[model samples]
Target chain A: MDIFSFVNFFLLPGVVQGSIYALGAIGITLIYAIMRYGHFAHGDLATFGAFTALFVAGLLGLSPYAALPVAVVVAALLAIAIDWLFYAHLRRMPKIITTIASFGVALMLRSVVQIIWGVDTTSYTRGISRPENWFGIRVKPHELVTLLVVIGLVIALHLFLTRNKWGKAMRAMSDNPDLALLSGIDNNKVIAMTWVIAGGLCAASGFFLGLNTELRSLMGWNILLPTFAAAILGGVGRIEGAIVGGLVVGVTEELSVLVIPSEYKMLSSFAILLVVLLLRPTGLFRGKIL
Target chain B: MDWLSFTIYPVYLMIFMCIYGCLAIGLNIQWGYAGLFNAGLAGFFAVGAYTSAILTTSEAAGRLGGFDLPFPFGLAGAMIVSGLIAWPVGKICLRFRSDYLAIVTIGVAEAIRLVAKTEDWLTNSARGITGVPRPLGDLPYAQAQLAYLAIVGLILIVVYLLIERQAHAPWGRMMRAIRDNERAAVAMGKNVPVRRLEAFMLGSALMGLAGGLYVHLARTITPDAIDPMLVTFLVWIMVILGGSGNNRGVLLGAVIVWIIWSASEIVTDQLPAEFALKAKYGRMFLIGLLLQIVLRFRPEGLLPEKLRRAPLSEGALSPTGHGARIQAPHKEI
Candidate 1:
């Protein structure tokens, strides 16, 4: 493909989609690190967030981007409530039980979305968005917004993880919960904060995804494997690694159409995931596996 | 409901219960004995269904599978193909914790679904394969249903006996040992990975058989026939609730869960047109929530595994102590 066509068709769109995946991966990584189990409900939780945004946007007659904050709060609260109600009792149980419960939560969440919003695919805006020519590469307003929001969120998270006390405590917990507890960190607060951050990022991921394409009850469920792949590929616990992994997965998925049929793009992520697990389960950044 | 119709309803339901009973038993071998979580039961199920459908069905224009093979051959092909698919997935993930196995299985299931949807030449795309030959399909309606139920019941009995034998044998003991204490099993010179892989493959094969039976009964196969969460999670709940390690319990669980599931469908289907779709999802929400309640209140299930006395050794009881967690969290992914 020519440079302009490659950029327009693959690179640009890949990065935009990658940003959304990165946001979701960050949540997965956080949950994996702190909770010690995969949250199978995460994708549906994202669907919940996006549809929550859709609801707010419809009521207010505002752009979907304008409803991001309210949606994030709603999703965050829901995450916390889920953790408190369902997971807290199973803290002493086997990790697999919690994971299974998360699967249950996923189903519940998806059903809620389907019931509230119905199953039809809906978009933030009705009109077809015409991409603007920018140095021969096509760009859309929402794409630009997605990029800006991702960059902004990443920078803010970076600062929080480094400079904020709770963020540092979360890092400490991720490293070794027992040691962190011995060192006088409030494990409950750190757990709550982790959910907050993960939930917020999940909302952003779902919103940006809806902004880029369209929102369906299963939009998050479809991309879930890729998000998990990105998290695993980047190393399970590394923030920067998730972003890099997400972009690589995204770009490769888009670029794969050059050689293989476009329909098989989803298969590529699974291949990448298996290859990574075989070669380096620790991920590219040497993060913790669990 | 009339008494005769009600009697037939349960008979019809029994066929499904037997089919899903096979799936639950297969999972019991994997999770209950082996401690390997195979989350993509539906994927293996789909592989079996499609393979059997393609193998036994008469040919049509613009699609594959005109072999018109015998029913037994198609069923065996279903098992083999499903096991073949599980082999690679097991090889990759079995070396790790059950968590990785679970995630990879989900990935495999999703990829399989995508292929079933997009590969027109292979699966006939969304149209699906038709004319799958049933063993007693040529009979009158009630007779066919009764005959099919008999066939499925016989298969379930045979499978149950075979699996129950394995579960009580030295092999089953070794599997439980490996699951309870991997380190001890490894130190005892047990090939942990290989044994786990065998269980995984065996379970997948049974699931495939169930799928084959399902397709044959329906006389059709479609991408939409399988719902990953609905089938897989429901089976998981069945095994867990039925008593994971007990064959009889697994069968009982399958019957109970399937009844609740199908009966709920009947109820939801009766709702007004506008509320029908919402009620459908509402039922899903209830099933999902039911899993949580079961896990929380009754982790041992209705019929807990009958504990058997093991020949004691000092090596078996180590620092981990007795009653080791069912699935120890593996630090290394």
Candidate 2:
């Protein structure tokens, strides 16, 4: 393929989609690091956040972008509530129970979305969005916005983790919970803060996905496996790794249609996941093994 | 409902209960005894279902099947095929903790579903494979249903007896020992990874048996018919609520949860057209809530696993710790 065709059709769209996946993977990585288990419901949490933005945008007659802040806050609170109500009691239990409980939460969250919005595909606004051409490449306004927001969020997160007290505490807890606790870090507060950051990012990812494509009830569930593959492939607990992993997975999947049938696009992410597991279980960045 | 119709409904429900009972029993072996979290219950079930369907179904023009095997042979093939699928997955994943297994299993199930969707020559794609003859197909409708129920019930009984025997066997004790404390079990010369793989494969084989029975009962196999999340989660809830380690409790759980699931659908379907769809989702919401509640309050489930005490030889109890490990029941659940 020529450079223009590759850049416009495959590369640009891949990066746009990659940004969304990166946003979701960031949350998955955070939860995996801080909570010490795979939060299966993270995908649905994104769906909920996106729909929450959609709902508010409808109520206020505002653009979806305008409603982003409210959606982020609401989603973060919902995350905290879910943790307190469902996962807190299972703290002493095995990691598997919490993981299973997260699956239940996924079901509940998706059903709630279905019940509220019905099953039809909906979007932020009703109209075709044409991409503006820049020299040889074309990009949609919303896609550009998604990419910008993701970059901004990642930079902010990097600063927070490196400079902020609570962020450092999160890293410490992730490294060694017992030792972190012994060192006077408030475990509960760190956990709550982890959910806040993860939940907000999850909302942004879901919102961006809705912006880039249309929103459907099953969208989150469908993308969930790939998002997880990105997280694991990047190395579970590493922030920078999630971004690189997401981009690689997204770009590779988009490019894979050249070799394989389009219907089997999803299988690539899984193939990458298995290959990574077999070759290097610690992932590219050497994050947590589990 | 009339007497015959009412009678048939219960029989239908009972047949499903038996099928799911087989599933729960299998899960109990894996999660309950071995502490392996297998989230892909439907994948194994599908392998069994498709394997049996291919083996027993009549000739079709474009598809791969028409082996025209006997029902017993089909069922056995189902178990073996599912076990084979599990073998490599267990080999790779058993080395890690349960969390990794859960993720890999989910991926495997999704991949299997995708394969079934895309592989037209194998599964006939969306058209699916039809004309798979049910056992005793010549009998009257009610009679056929009852006969199939009997067959499934018989299978359930045989599986129950076998698994129950194994649970109380020396091997079963060793499994629980390994699950309760892997390090201690290893110190006592237990090959933890291999034994765990065996448990995973065996449990998957039973799940396959359930799938074979299911396809035979339905008389058709389609990708959509097996709703992965619904079936897998239902089986998980059944085993968890009934008591993971206890075989009898697992069976009771299967019946109770299946009844609730089906009954809710019947009730929800009665709602007006506008509300009916929402009510359907409401049922799902309730089921999910049910899992959280069950996990919170009744973590051991309705029927907790019973502890057993078996005598050990003098040399066998060398570590003195071996006796404590033996007597220390599997309390992790």
Task: Kindly report the docking quality category of candidate 2.
Answer: medium
> What TM-score does the first chain of candidate 2 have?
0.99
Q: Measured against the native two-chain assembly using Cα atoms, what DockQ does each of the candidate structures obtain, in the order listed?
A: 0.63, 0.54
User: Distance from true position, residue A191, model 2, in Å?
Assistant: 0.6
Q: Pick the candidate with the highest DockQ.
A: 1
lDDT of 1 by residue, A29-132 (tens): 98889877888888888899999999999999987878999999999999999999899888776687788888889999999999989999998898888999
Residues B160-188, candidate 2: write the lDDT tens digits: 99999998998998999898778899999
How many backbone clashes does every candidate have?
A: 0, 0
Which pairs clash in the backbone of model 2?
Answer: none
Docking quality class, candidate 1:
medium
Backbone clashes in model 1, listed as residue pairs: none
Cα lDDT of all candidates, in order?
Answer: 0.87, 0.88
Among these predictions, the greatest lDDT belongs to: 2
- Per-residue CA lDDT of model 1 for B100-201, tens digit only, reads 888899999988898999998899989999878899788767778888899899988999999989988889889888877688889999999899999999
